[model samples]
Target: MISKISSQRTRCKSWLLGGLFCAVACVAQSQAAGVTWSSQYQDRLFDSGGGVLDTQFSFEVGIFLPGFTPTASNVDLWESNWRTLDRAYDPTPEDPNDGDPEGWNVPEQFFVGYYQIEAGGYSSSPDADPLYAFPGGAQAYLWVYDSKSLDAPREWALLTDGITADNLADAWVVPDADAGSLEWYLEDLDVVIYGGGNDLQGPGGYTLDPVVFSLQTHSVAVPVPEPGSALLVGLTLGLAALLRRRGLSAARG
Candidate 1:
């Protein structure tokens, strides 16, 4: 009988110790893990149509990818002061009969994204189509081809739609155009092919483009207790429990 009781006591003690050790270890480990990331691309703003006019081109950083899959969820309206330098600016029959322009110019660019989701929209041009290049259409996907790593010609996605030569300029916001301090997320990171129409083909059929921008990666340090510390904590709790049980038994006797 004594042997049996002793064995039970020993087992209880071990369990208590183990529990304590686990708790401690968990705390330690949680404090030890660390993470790092690359720099963030700044907002890019430049001119085109006249020539390969590019200046500030960069990407927004720290956006959670898995979360930003694609949806009308976060719609935002963008306005641009652009003019259709192309005199032959004609829309396809399928194109919505919104209105005819005397000539495409000032306050002509308007774009929407995450609009339905967030209930917001903007326009650079007063006379622009709401559905010009919506993500839900052929101009749905946005590609950020890593010019340095991937092949240029095949590694891009249709970021935004209404992205015509004229429309592209509509979205173009010069540094001076930034009303108040403006903050923009990098939407498209691609080589601005001077004349590459909506097709967006590469120069030499390479994987990536000369233009490359990236979002800043944000990280937080995770605390991970050392294995040894965890073990010790668990052991202490287990032992304490076992001892408490023994005391109760002794009182009953």
Candidate 2:
């Protein structure tokens, strides 16, 4: 009877140790497989006269990836706008209702998307080299209408293959990295606004332009242990403690 009891205790300890090891492995796997890509937009607005305005707008979005890492060659081609809540608008001195002044709300409804273009295809100007020269030949862009032009939406739609504000609601979907032509990934992102100057007239005859536009991208890893794994670890430890108490009671008996 003594030998049999000893063998049972050894088996129980071995099983408890195995359960602990499995719990640790689960946490390590989650850390290695989960990654999220994030993009941020920042801009400083100025009046047509080049005086810095009190208004500012900034936005950020995050895309989750399971078992994936962003690389220049693995980026996908896609376009979509983030949710309205992701858009940040500061109060402008000229317009109290919305930070943006009348006839100058272009940034309020811009789209964020990725496109693949030949090297130097999308230059700052007709004579300038490409604004972004990524190794994998892909670029990210923010598509917005001209704030001062009455026909800006139509012109923007025509340039972007019929994408307009009317149809933007349907295009607001989470991007699938594996669905499109894999040309590049979010290893790094840089966006520079060109051509348009801070000369557009805003409400009350106040002209405004984006004097500073900056885009930044980065990746974050989120590792959370699975609930099941945590429960299993807890149960194993509890059972080991119970067994020890029972063993001590048996010896006393």
Q: Return the top candidate by TM-score.
A: 2
TM-score of each: 0.19, 0.25
Q: Write the per-residue lDDT of candidate 1 for residues 115-146, one digit (tens) a residue.
A: 11001122223232433321211122222221
lDDT string for model 2 (1-253, tens) is 9999999999999999999999988754333111122222223333333343223322222221233333322222111211111222333635534634222242433223232223222221222134433222122232221131222111110001122244312222232322233221111222222212122221222233343422211111123467999999999999999999999999999
Per-candidate local distance difference test: 0.28, 0.31
Superposed model 1: Cα runs more than 4 Å off: 32-145, 149-253
Enumerate clash totals for all models, in the order shown.
67, 3
**lDDT computed for candidate 1:** 0.28
- RMSD value for candidate 2: 27.0
